[model samples]
Target chain A: MAKTKARVKVPKSIKKGEVFQVKTLISHKMETGQRKNKKTGKKISRMIINKLVCQYNGKEVFASDWHPAISANPYMAFYVKADASGSLDFTWTDDEGKSVKKSAKITVAG
Target chain B: MIHKTLETRQVGRRELMAMFGAGVVAAMGVGMTPRDAMADAKSVTDAMMKVVGDNKPATGKIKLDLPQIAENGNTVPIAVEVDSPMSDADHVKALHLWADKNPRPEVASFRFSPASGKAKVSTRVRLSKTQNIVAVAEMSDGKFYMAKSEIKVTIGGCGG
Candidate 1:
């Protein structure tokens, strides 16, 4: 397993009240616990990101509950309306209470 | 004389077909492999019913976009949007996605707030086979809207 990396993209030109897209990508094996280890003949336990949430400024804007059906190296895109200058926080958490957090800044002047 | 005897011992096509059919039927039977069990329409509806409950989602506000045919099932791109004003008074509460043919019915669910200016999202999902992808949108008022579309997968994502 390699080091987990989370990437986020925000449009360079975000104006006040304008609807913009926020893209996110993360690296994970997303093991579904269905396959058996070839040599050991033991079922590989499931390990996947269980949820992702986004917070704008101090408020929660978007969140996702992910199941194993989500493909490996998960990618998600969503829209956000920035009414004022604030920071965006993204967190991806797995079943065992482990989580990855990333943040971005946006300047929307009134 | 031995070659003639060997030909007579060879299995006939009719018998071979019967054996293949039985294998398929056995695979389709319940409890064969619960982790990779194929889902049917009734099972899909029942699972959706568990979420939407008595509201009975209507089919108008959701736009589920999926490819008519996916060459690769490992990473089929999908997008969904619901018709909503996204105002604090009336906004989309959540969006749920389901791949009916997968062993598990629930794919993912996204919660939205007014700050999410648009009730739109896009993501990638794994499809076990050719099946319907269902999307349901829940409005702030508790009304649910449903939309379903099918994707034909040439190769299933799940490999045994």
Candidate 2:
């Protein structure tokens, strides 16, 4: 069994209708199947974050599917328009059939 | 292969201040003197050539933004902006970022569509040492644009 970890961080409060930046980074080796194990002399099976999806208040804000070329410890940042106070959910899935999820809540002030 | 040209077009204080304006240049937080920055630029350029292949002339136009001196190398702020409207008729196809001297040369590559609205991206990256950062932007019309800058890393970043 493999252990996977993910963390999500966002401001506790935000102004409604104002645009704010969101940053995310997941801890993973992102092994590209191309590498070979020195001891076994066999190609190491790929273990990577195949997909990342972010939803704000049940509406999709951003999503991306990664490839072997992506570097280790992938970090992503983007802007989100805060329409109303809501929860932001982040989900990441790997090719190995494993998925990790985390979320953050933001309060929109008038 | 086009990275050589990028190495030559080093963004000096005068040039950088010209493109981004004095406000941006000031925000960069450069601690080193002009002489030191120039020396670091040369070394960083040499390091980039080692990883990007032989004699490839990287072009200009890709806009790269980084702090002149980073207090922490573990989380250095980075931004890449390209001059593309990102419309159906014309758009930025892809943007690639490379740290001249990180353990891994290629940091990240973003593929965009007309729906992206803008060809700009901001993120944080880890720098192992003082080095030059390079960004290459590819347009839908099959043209390449690039930008580079020297960043002084006070402390070694990358969990070493």
Candidate 3:
């Protein structure tokens, strides 16, 4: 099995109802189904990070559907409004049903 | 180091496609099949319909950033930005991207809420050949906006 790691960056605290940026990057090869192993001479099956979803305070703030066309080690950035103090969850799902999850805390300053 | 590895891999992919008699596809000129291009167009149309229903996406508001020419098809950098206030009253809800020539038309999508301060995303995608990259942004009021850019790819991004 291939190793995976997910990274997220968000502000420690934000004003209530303020929109802030969220950045995410994942480590994955994103092997497209077109390559072949040099030694075995067989096609390497395609395995890529297919989807990403981000939730803030249990509400879906951002989501993405990715294809093999996306480069390896995907990086995406978006903005979100900070409604209340809560955890921002990031989940990445791959082609094989494998998922990597990470979260960061966001505190809304009154 | 990354460029070196990608160069080698691109060469390998090109050679493999040649071995499989797909060299003609590389020379897309007059030899390219109309049916293939039609299929590609259909997929992109379906993807657009899925997002905006029957509504026609108006131009402007969305900007597509991509290289005018890409030496490598495996990794083409792209960015989509929508001009919006991103407030609770009016914000971008979702963004969808498509490649008009790849085996699969849908490239990537992004969903956003008002909490997100802006509507912009940057990523790298594979292009099968010289084709246009289309992006559609769905707004809070159920309106769709679109933008596209043409990019030339030397080698196919998806498996030829």
Top-DockQ candidate index: 3
DockQ of each: 0.41, 0.08, 0.50
TM-score of each: 0.82, 0.52, 0.75
Question: How would you encode candidate 2's per-residue C-alpha lDDT over B77-102 as one tens digit per residue?
Answer: 87777877666689876665667777
- When summed lDDT is taken over every stretch of 10 residues in candidate 1 chain B, the lowest stretch is B32-41
Q: What residue pairs clash in candidate 3, if any at all?
A: A79-B116, A80-B115, A80-B116, A81-B115, A81-B116
Summarize candidate 2's per-residue lDDT along A9-78 as a digit string, tens digits: 6777877666566778888887766567788766687777766777888876655545443546777765
Candidate 3 CAPRI grade: medium
Interface RMSD over true interface Cα atoms for each candidate: 4.1, 8.8, 5.2
Candidates 2 and 3 compared by TM-score, better number: 3
What CAPRI class is candidate 2?
incorrect
Query: Which candidate wins on TM-score?
Result: 1
lDDT of 1 by residue, A11-107 (tens): 7657799999999999998887666788876768889997899999878999998887888999999999978887899999987889999998888
lDDT, candidate 3, at B138: 77
Q: Which ten residues in a row have the lowest lDDT in candidate 2 chain A?
A: A62-71
What TM-score does each prediction get for chain A alone?
0.93, 0.91, 0.91
Q: Native-vs-model 2 lDDT?
A: 0.64
Cα deviation of B1, candidate 3, in Å: 37
* Candidate 2 vs. true structure, TM-score: 0.52
